[model samples]
Target: MKKKKQEEKEGEEEGRKSMILLSERQMKEIYERAATIGAKEALKFFEAERKKEYKGRADKRLGNTKLLLRNYHMLKDHAEKSVFGRTQMEESALDILESMMSMYDNEVIIESIKRSATRTAVIVSHIETMLGLYEAYCDKSRSREIERRRYEALWDMYIAASTMSPKEIADKQHVSKDTVYADLRIAIEKITALIFGVDGLTVR
Candidate 1:
């Protein structure tokens, strides 16, 4: 029995070692997203005692681990909100799940996210796991910029615009129908470049 427990401990440590840490920019983005989802307390937790300068990867990892382990509740809230609309599996609630074990915990959360069947869910799973890596790997500001740009260019709402007619779009945008078409083309090209970082897209 002692041998079995020793093996399990070794296995968990090995799993922790395998988890990848997120880039600093990525962590910033995660924080921003967490904030957007009303995770003020979690944000406060992350904000506390942040390293002014991570001397090296070792320094960064240790800092992140301590941050995540201590503030997992915030990540938990963020994850739950990310999948708010989806059916919580009768099998489990994401908020109640632990992320400390790495593989097993991640798999369960990922399954729950998948069952939610939304792009937001997938991103949330990635964010939550990345948070744990810091606790164990570990931005939204840029995303808001991207979204603002997309809306300005496309003149559309991801959730609501699909139901709108071109006339309605023109009316809402306060532009002529022809202008709306032209702007939409430019918008698509701009968005393509922002996402793909290629200038090859042209308005047609």
Candidate 2:
């Protein structure tokens, strides 16, 4: 009886070992599948994030283009002015305390404004150059009539600083309001690419 009991105990030990080994094999297979799935999911997530970032950058570029065009005249005026001299800074800060006078002399603010003015001048010059090219192109070929209309629409709406409404622009262009709006949009898209580079062009 004691020998039989010992044999039964040995059989139970062997069974437990077999079950453990089977479980380990199954776990390894599950882990491999999970890793594969996780990698694919990670890649998809990364791609989606990249697209969002790209779209965000494109939108920002478009917004900047619109802003620069709208403020074209004002920026040009600012660009023509020389940087503030020491006397000018002192005069501007005359009311402030002596201790706070250093704020007026802050090179950082002055440099930042100077840089902004320079960039504005550069962008405005690009707009003018592009418009000049467009004018020449429009005149060179009657087939580009629609393109010419779009260019005129953009100029009247922004570059000319005219107070003309969209309806007025449409009447002047001899097109529907919707056409004028579309032209303006297309013009802005083209200029956005010019100002911000090719990547500024949105997919849509």
Candidate 3:
């Protein structure tokens, strides 16, 4: 058993040495290949998470829509009541309508902004809202801008992940396949920036 262990250790040492002696190009190729696999896995995880989030959002939106429609019908019926009753009903209807409109506007804005934004921005914004930043920020425009920056950060992450796929990233980054791996380090820095909000990328 000891002899076998010794042989295994030697083999491992030889392998390490060979790896350590690899040319820069060879090492980069290996790193890129490994990064490609890691990026694909990360993307799959992200996509699954997004799907779950979308389903929850969709269900909530549907329920709100139903509630809005019910309120609308109730308000319409009350519109034929006595003056005081009509006024009260009208007020209630307006409240519900306002709530519905606010939700509608938010959805529209999210959709429009997301189209041009990065995934990082969307994720960060969603996280911030979930954390009750809306209450703290109290300004819709400012909140949306924060979300936009988050999206840009996410885009940068995506770009970095793409760089792992050397062949595709080579052309995209306008660099040779041999040099594309360098971008991975740059990407890591960008991701760190996004996470840390070092460049005022995060909303306060």
For 48-151, candidate 3 gives per-residue lDDT tens digits of: 88877655554444444333222332332333342332323322322332333345454553343233223223333333342243223323545554443333
* Alpha-carbon deviation at 71 in model 2, angstroms: 0.4
Q: Provide the overall lDDT of each model, using Cα atoms, as 2-decimal numbers.
A: 0.43, 0.67, 0.43
Model 2 ranges with Cα > 4 A deviation: 1-25, 82-119, 133-143, 161-163
lDDT of prediction 1: 0.43
**Candidate 1 wrong stretches, greater than 4 Å:** 1-120, 123-157, 161-163, 199-204
lDDT of 2 by residue, 21-137 (tens): 757778999999999999999999999999998887777667656766666676667766645334434222112212222333344323433355444344445667766765676
Off by over 4 Å in 3: 1-21, 69-73, 78-204
> For model 1, how does the per-residue alpha-carbon lDDT over 1-204 read when each residue is reduced to its tens digit?
999999999999988876646678988998899778777776766655342222232232333333333334444444565544446434332332222223334444444434443432434354444333322200133455434433443434222324355567778767687776665544444433332223223322
Candidate 3 lDDT score relative to the true structure: 0.43
Per-candidate clash tally: 11, 0, 4
TM-score of each: 0.26, 0.66, 0.30
